[model samples]
Target: MKFYRLTFLASVFLTAVMLLLVYVFDSAKHSFSETNKQFFQTLIISALILSVINYLVVDFLFNFYGKRQIQKISTILPEEIRDEESNLNFKQLSQKFTDLNLKNTTEIDMMKEMEFYRKEYIGNISHEMKTPLFTIQGYVDTLLEGGVENLAIRDKYLERIDKSVERLLNIVKDLDMINQFESGEIILNKSRFDLNEMIREMIDVLDLEAQKKNTKIVLQTTSNLMFVNADQQKISQVLLNLISNAIYYSNRESATVTIKTKVENHKVLVEVEDNGMGIKAEMLPRIFERFYRIESSRNRSDGGSGLGLAIVKHILEAHGESIAVESVYLEGAKFSFSVAKAI
Candidate 1:
């Protein structure tokens, strides 16, 4: 820090020295005697030296007394950007540092993301627990108030309780998967897998639900045996969730959700395109956000908890892949994502 300050001061002093030489050549070069010219030059040099000493002493005192706090904190910073934090006499030092440097962008984004996850994890747990607690309380209250004698009513209460328990179990599983992802504990078992076959497998799993609504799932791909290198189980879960979401949100009787795959620019791309009611333009960017739902998609028929897309996002990101979407308000929606190249 001190050397950097000295270097700046030296540059200023060098400019002053040049001005003095120019002034002497103009003012005394033609009119003065050799002795007088020499005296003038000596005077300028003396003044320059004194000026530097005064400037250094003042700058040193100002830095030591006024900026000492920041200097103390400078120990935490990387050497190259120490000066940007040297003026940190205020509480917004971190904000100022973030605004000044590239490194801070990555760190600040991580901080904000971690903060978001902290809040979301708490909220999701509360929400998932609320329904079960309410069901358990209602069932216990009913049994205590003499409804237990009615075998059919008692069975109904038990069934509701069981349903709530199952949902809570699902929530716990989702939470466990998310925790593993955040903790860097999830290890992918990448292998060659038939992308088209996997889509067919997912369609088999969800085709009954689609049939009940008269919706059809069309499978299309550049190749039937387009192989992909990915964590087969994790990628399957992501694709299943996306395709199911598409099927669930399609409002028309003739709704068609297509699963397609291809090899593009050395990456294997998979897309789930649906001619559903489509997502709102405003909600497009935030759909993958945890616990977020398209308000118009209020029906339970839209499928499981809003955690599905968020889970998909984490799984893809964990595998160094990414997801994107395009939607027209009433026309359709397309979700495209890519995995590592097939080899």
Candidate 2:
């Protein structure tokens, strides 16, 4: 509407100026002859014709260039956002483009983060495998270089080789288990089991190891038999990992690792807490990340695959649950998770 209005006004002004020039020329001539009258009429008709032509040309150019620009912009937009039957709305198009750019930026950032983690994971895996591989190679080379003929040396080298092989196998096994859990390949065989009994069994299993660290494994609960419906084997692994970590990381001379369970709603809340070298506040968030360690030197010395907590997290998540942690830097850390009570 504005374009047409402006074009009409310009054409009218041009016509008025032309009429004024004709009037001035006639006045200067000061004649009212037939020839002068014909000239005046012809000049008036010419002005009107030129004005109409000018208006048409301006309108044609405006529509042509404006539609072309809209079409070019439409091509860059997603099909769903484009309007084919009508001219494009500039405001809507600008907002959509802004949103699309923001979405792309977020996705790019996430990809970069994932790539970083991938590289770090690969490096950690290489370092972990290389250490044991080198140890095994050294032992085997020594045995082949005449050490096999000695009775005691041969036995010792073979034993060390076996241990290295076991460690490698453990790494492979843990990796495979994690992959299975992540890919949804491991199906839970849920069953009714006594939570208290399982805690006792795990404590007994790790009793010897706890004794080495002078740590005591204690179970505290109000109920004797708190039954839960869960994957018994996986739950056992979770308990084992948490309990073992508690004993291993304890800073005290005689550490106390406690396993507690209580009834909450219709669920069983189980907690494994210890008076150990509690993890730093900053380290707690990444504690369940695969191959993440609080103290790398000490963690490696403990001969862990470093996938324990990660596996524990995966198992619990698969059972439609989540685990929580609490800790103070030097006091202790507690890991707790809930399971549905068997009906």
Candidate 3:
């Protein structure tokens, strides 16, 4: 419509200019014949009009396509994205598009990571469960195949089956405990207790393992009793897990595992250090992840539910504390945590 209006006005102006020129330059002797004058003016006007119409058509097509492309872009957006009167500029639209693209990319990456972890988790669970299940099945089969008729064989098979069953029970219990901790179902029974004394008790409980490994367990501290304000039982569990890990992973023939405590500000920092095949720097960050074994083959032989470190971490976090690990590849590893000091 705009192009048509402009062309009509341009034609009128050109026609007026022609008439004015003819009137201004007319001569009496060579005055143009009316028919001849009309014919010549018609020829000039036809050429001029055709050129103008061609330029107008090109200009109109350019604008038409530009508007059509913009309209196509607008339709890709949802209706609720903008109000009818909100005239968004190209720059603003481009920024919004970039933001949406980034968000989509992040979500996609997260989903892929989750899928990978899911497969790893399932594989680990199956392997962990299957070992004990198979052992128990084998022992039962042995007893059924006339081994039960012999008193000696029957007793041995029964013992082996009992041990396998116990391992299964431990795994199940650890799983249940971790589930409860994650779901916020277990409430802490916080109280004031002697941290050092608790460590002593835990050492006594783990004495056989330490002796078996020929590792000497020692406690080093400024005082024998460093009291802390938290759940004693949970803290004991943390100590047991860390100390036991230290003992189990120790590579030295006569490894010395140390439990040390210090008072810093209003917190008691406890560290379990061992001169063992220390964890590699790369594995430190993931040491507390559930079922993440530093030495899968050796750890399996050592025997555990593989949820010990994870449980310890959750227990510390529940008490508003945090745990950290420091280690060199071959020197040794130290696991530490801080708890509020009893006033």
Candidate 2 regions exceeding 4 Å error are 1-68, 72-87, 299-301
**What would the per-residue lDDT of candidate 2 be over residues 1-343, giving only the tens digit for each residue?**
3365655766687677667767765776654466777667866886787677767767665765565677777767676566443464455556767887898899999999999998998988887788789889998999889999999999999988888888888889999999999899999999999999999999889999999999999999989999999999999999989999999887699799999999999999999999988989999999999888888676352478889999999999999999999999889999999998999
| Tens-digit per-residue lDDT, 252-324, candidate 3 | 8879999999999889999999999998878888988888988856646247888899999999988888999
What residue pairs clash in candidate 2, if any at all? none
Which one is best on lDDT? Answer: 2
- Model 1 residue runs over 4 Å out of place are 1-121, 296-303
lDDT of 1 by residue, 21-45 (tens): 6786678557767778676777788
- Best-to-worst order by TM-score is 2, 3, 1
Taking every candidate in turn, the Cα RMSD to the unseen true structure, in Å, is: 8.4, 9.1, 9.3
User: Which is the winner by TM-score between candidate 2 and candidate 3?
Assistant: 2
